[model samples]
Target chain A: MTARGGIDLGGTKIQAVVVGEDHEVLGQARRPTPTTGGPQDVADAMAGALGDAAEAAGVRTKALGGVGAGSPGIVDAGAGTVSGARNLPGWEGTFALGDALSRALGCRVALGNDVQVATDAEFALGVGRAYHSLLGVFWGTGVGGGIVLNDEPWLGRGAAGEIGHVVIERDGLRCPCGRRGCMEAYAGRGALEIRARKLEAKGEKTKLFKLMEEHDRPRLTSGIWARALDQGDKLATSLIDEAIAALGVGVASVVNVLDVEAVVLGGGMGVRFGEPFADRIREAMAPHLFSSDNPPVFEIAALGDLGGAIGAAMLVA
Target chain B: MTARGGIDLGGTKIQAVVVGEDHEVLGQARRPTPTTGGPQDVADAMAGALGDAAEAAGVRTKALGGVGAGSPGIVDAGAGTVSGARNLPGWEGTFALGDALSRALGCRVALGNDVQVATDAEFALGVGRAYHSLLGVFWGTGVGGGIVLNDEPWLGRGAAGEIGHVVIERDGLRCPCGRRGCMEAYAGRGALEIRARKLEAKGEKTKLFKLMEEHDRPRLTSGIWARALDQGDKLATSLIDEAIAALGVGVASVVNVLDVEAVVLGGGMGVRFGEPFADRIREAMAPHLFSSDNPPVFEIAALGDLGGAIGAAMLVA
Candidate 1:
């Protein structure tokens, strides 16, 4: 049976995987996202990543069944276009990402929202399989969410499950999206770094940036955060604490509305912090939850780093 | 051609109606809800109101096809019990509301959450007929919400659509439920009245209570608010403004997650304030909406005061 390829295009990195018919990963590849180019440059990197994954699987790109990608933007699946992917350089407008990738790889390509695809993967094959309804909270460069209702993904008017944008405090802080008091304003890694830099410039001491340079990394990836925590960096700890607090209120607000059966925490920060941080968030949710007695069961995503890629592949499957 | 009876059990009033097959109200009656009695008194009042409607419709209570009611609380449709209806005097635990009403009216009674059934009505026959997914925001004694997804009600874990409980601010004012920062903390009429009284006692100028007394209202009903607005009562206006602001953030947060196709505004204030307030809410949602360009259609509940009762009658239909 021919293998299928999946691509997870995120703000900081691109992950690609080749999977067999049983949804078992055969091979995978990762590449740094372009920080200076346009959508075309990102599309090229995606193609290259899939090519490497196919090579690792002992198959040719042309022989694959299909390829699917999870992109951070407004995905028009039928039109094969992506729009408003601001996290990517010079990609503030629509681009024919699907067509471009398909042409380069000599196969069909399907697209979906990055976080939503990861959520779908969890629901179909990971910890979410235990419940009929779930909320997937992906804490990465930016906080993202995916919602499942009655075992089906709920893409509300093409933009549902925007948990990151939910206001945690009324007009309290500025978000990366220029909005105020959104959960992402505090919890998203990108926002956290910005806050760190501003505070560091104002005389606060921290090893976050120094650690990034020591690791030869341009961005404060999850690894840098983990290292900072290991070193007991006070600034990093404070920002993370604030993030957890924001997530506690923000996530509880979502649960108060949907009252889903379970919650799965994934994404960079989620997977990095793991069960311990999940407990902290759940504890913080206590005071804000409307149904205090019947809280949703919380769990970390079981599929780990490859969850997004696998979920993307399901778009074609 | 048998008619059906429907009851809307609210915090301050009990409304009942007998409806024809076409969902047209054949007869209706309204009665003040008892503030001093327990669940039994509230149940008795519900039966008396239905009896008056049945009498006016020239049909015996037992001769009607069936009866349906919309009650506020944790409703167990399977067991026909309602629990935690705190707004009703002395009703803090499970009560066999369905069986009690059935025994009094000599008919089978079906029960549902007050807001959900009203939303069902709007989706089936009211302004919500235009959309496949809808969110019903009922602004009244307390802010209530009901959700419909893909033309079906989405009741997740038996307690979905608690839009009132969604936090609007971090560590904000205390809610009637004793929770902090909840939308209902600022917007619920019960909370509003309490604040008005507190401010009045603290020497704030307001004709709100005087207007309530002049209208012979046992509580500050929707009519009293409208009258106070017309008289330009500063305190009432200020309180209402705060409620609207809180609702703006709370409702937008829900929209950010659900992204339903339409929003139907019902309940006491919604119907009383009508189109203008709905517009105000729409404006308020602008800043907080994730997909601001593709906003949901907004409208006041078209069925007016009878929507909830009519929706309840549908339970038997």
Candidate 2:
């Protein structure tokens, strides 16, 4: 079984893995994403992460057959470029990310959208394996989504499955994408953090920021939220309630349109909150559902944090 | 050339068509749906309608290759049955509609969903021909949607494209389906009519009901709406404006999930108001769009009222 390398480029972390045939992880590494660098520096960090993984796997980086990476942005898979990844610092225009990675690692590099790869991994070898059609809802920095229809990815015009932007209200709260009334405006981690800070500035009593500071997190990380929930932070619970309501509307609305057999929830919050949160989202979806009698079942994505990197590795496979 | 018969069963009327090998309509007929009868009588009317069209085409109904039909409800295409068609009078349980029509007409029968067939027709020979992926939004008594992805219908779990049920608000207006804040709650003709009557009872001024009475229509049909708009009826225009706004959010929301290449607007309201209404909906969709830079284009369905029947005929073809 030949070894292949993979990378997952997120707003907070760069994850890398070296996998052998059958997708068993041979080695893995993780590094915090640079908060102040441009695309080139981000690309260098991704290369370094892969190199660390290759070293752990007892192989030279150049000895691996190829490497695959999942990155945020509007990806042109054919062109190996990423554009408009506003979540990354100074990632303004298109960058040949694949080429850059390949130059540093001495092999071909395949590029995919971050969430799409994670969804693909879940569909291929995780919770979505039993279903013919599945919608992978990854609730994280921005509530991203990916679709698999009839056992194939349905990337309509190359940009399908943008569920976070579904308008849950007409002209409501502003979204991170600059849109108003989007599901992400209410439910995305970035938006939630922004909302929390706004409320705190206006003298709203809350332990969310305090918890983040205690944990040394630059943002309201999922771990801090979990801690805040345990302490029964008023602001945290209230915002989480709103997020559940918005997610219910958004996810249920998608289920009504696609009617997939299953929904696999992933990403940061989805994994952290798990069964209880899924149950709440299900209860929320019940009212908005049109085909309530024959609704799709829900599952937490089974691959955990390494899903995107593993999926990218499979691109080489 | 060989001939085939097609039928479309609607809430108000039954439409039938006979087509040649080239799919050119050789004969057509229309009849009022029995507002009181069960599925058996409805099947009989469908048979009779096809007989008239076959006669007009100078062919015997039994001599045709086969006949196809588009009906509202959950269709079991393999079983040739329709179930829970609440739009039709007293159609509660499953009925072997294809078998009944086949027995009466002495030919094999094929069945499909009405909105789906209309969407298929548009994809095959109408406005959606140029599109690789399409979302057909048909706004009639109820807002219905049909989807085509990668040149095939995406009927996930047999009940996809229920776009009317997509929740647009958190616990907003109650829908006819007993849900709150559905797109159809605001945009459907039935909902709009209900809202208008409610407002009129509350002393809201408008000529909607007067125009409906003058036209001798039991319901506010599309023609009456066009006339009311021409007369600048405040109540009618206000309701229409709400519909446009709701359509914007609903359609944009669907586009966010699918990112389809095109959207084909059909059904009664969509056809009557045409391009101007489409433009208004487009403007409304702009703000809620996730992929604002590369949005799907919109168009009116080109097949008019006969689209469904023609689409059903193609099933036989």
Candidate 3:
């Protein structure tokens, strides 16, 4: 029986899973991502996690066919190098992630960005399975997207699925990517936080600040935003509404151009808000649709947190 | 000795061409479109033009393998029906153009919208041949677009290339399609004329009105616009600048998402403005590109006026 190892490498955590030939998750393990260590340390931690996961599944490392990983930032899949990854500090420049992982595991390793991997997983085994063409958008630190066409990721030219960078507002807001009025500038978590800070500076009272204080966290998580919304915080409600509107415009442009069959919303914010956010996007996107009668179906991603790990494993499988 | 017939059915005229197996245009014919007649009369005119073109090519109707037509408006290619074609006043709703033309010509009839057919022509024999993924945009009475991926048109779902309807401005000008701030609402010929009229009403000195008076025409043609721009007409320069900016934004959004290898600019306006227009669009699009270093190449469609006819013929060939 053949099995595959998958790793999801994020800023905060590294998740590893062993998937059997039957596509069942046999075992999984996770560890806090080491920020103090360099790229080699992170790679070693990933390798250790993979071993623990395979051992937990009662499978020998030598028996595994291959391993795959989903990492943050710009990924050169062909060269197996990662760059521009802010989350993995000091992991900048061209790092041979695939080669390093392959050497560690003694097997071939495939790598893709986290969003693309998650999208592949959803397309193969989650809500996107029934659709021929799908666009998966994950709204976390920044808005990232992946395209699945004919059950394969449509990597146009070299870099495709930069939906977040697409301009939604002309000269509206400055994006971290050095562009003005991009979808990410309006809808990304960073953008939401910027608005929250501005509102707080203007003497606007909100439960978000209070919740963050209680949690003793410097950054506001999706959970904090969701709790504030639940508590009827005006600032949180307005920020979310603005984000949803921007996302709607960006998504509408994509649908108008590509006319994909379905769209899956994922990431921390997307998963937390769930159907309500999906419903708002659907409503806002309706006006811009050319094929309004036969519009694409909108759904929240069903795979939850395991999507990246499952998708990475499937890449090698 | 195989020959194919092609027809370009537009609001003002019908262009027909006969092409030999070597992709050479053997003969062609054109006639004024019948505005006073019903759908059948227009169909008869198209069939007559095809006969004339075949005869001019020194080939009998029986020698022609098949016929294809590129028409205006929303086309249901499978059903060979055209709908929402405002240019053809009485040809609204579903018109079985393919069945009618097929019966009249006594051969198979393939039908597509004008932009799609033109894109096919450009992709097959013109500037887009070298690229794997291509986007063809046409600026005429209204903005229109088509996509060619891997040398085949990417007709998404049922209606693929509605680039004109993509919103560039929120709550801006109203489009003929009952939408606000669509690319067409800003860049289309009608949109430009509206701006020209408003500028004239504000007592702006312009040669456009004078030229229109000299030509004694109610509508401004691409030729007139070009002449006005050449003569340094203030209104014409300003209006064209605005159109270029709007087009740049729309195209940038498309590039950021799809990241096609090349973009082919066609239609009357696209052809007339030529390199200067292409240059402006390229410069304006540079800021919005996610991959600015390796942006998609922009080129004017090389097939000239016969692109529609040739593409239509190739559809059957």
User: Per-candidate interface C-alpha RMSD?
Assistant: 0.7, 0.7, 1.2
Candidate 3's chain A scores what TM-score? 0.87
Judging by TM-score against the true structure, name the best candidate. Answer: 1
Model 3 chain B: ten consecutive residues of lowest lDDT: B215-224
Reported per model, the fraction of native interface contacts reproduced equals: 0.85, 0.96, 0.61
lDDT of 2 by residue, A204-254 (tens): 999998887888888887778888889999999999999999999999999
Candidate order (TM-score): 1, 2, 3
RMSD of each: 1.2, 1.8, 3.1
- The digit string of per-residue lDDT tens for model 2 on B1-317 reads 47999998876678899999888999999886776879999999999999999999999998999999999889998899999987777898999999999999999999999889999999999999898899999898789999999999988888899999888887889887788999999998878888989999999998999998998876777788889999999888889999999999999999999999999999878988999999999998988888888889899999888888899998889
Q: How far is A55's C-alpha from truth in model 2 (Å)?
A: 3.5
Tens digit of lDDT per residue, candidate 1, span B1-317? 68999999988789999999999999999999899979999999999999999999999999999999999999999899999998899999999999999999998999999999999999999998889999999998899999999999988888899999988888899899999989998998899999999999999999999999988989999889889999999999999888888888989989999999998989988898887877888888889998988988888999988899999999999
Q: Which stretches of candidate 3 lie over 4 Å from their true place?
A: A10-15, A29-64, A86-92, A99-108, A216-218, B11-13, B29-63, B100-108, B198-205, B216-218
Task: Give the candidate number with the greatest DockQ.
Answer: 2
Residue B16's lDDT within candidate 2 is 95
Lowest-sum lDDT 10-residue window in model 3 chain A: A85-94
User: How far in Å is the alpha carbon of B267 misplaced in model 3?
Assistant: 1.5
Give per-residue lDDT, candidate 1, residue B277.
79
What are the runs in model 2 whose C-alpha is more than 4 Å off? Answer: B58-60
What is the DockQ of the complex in model 2? 0.88
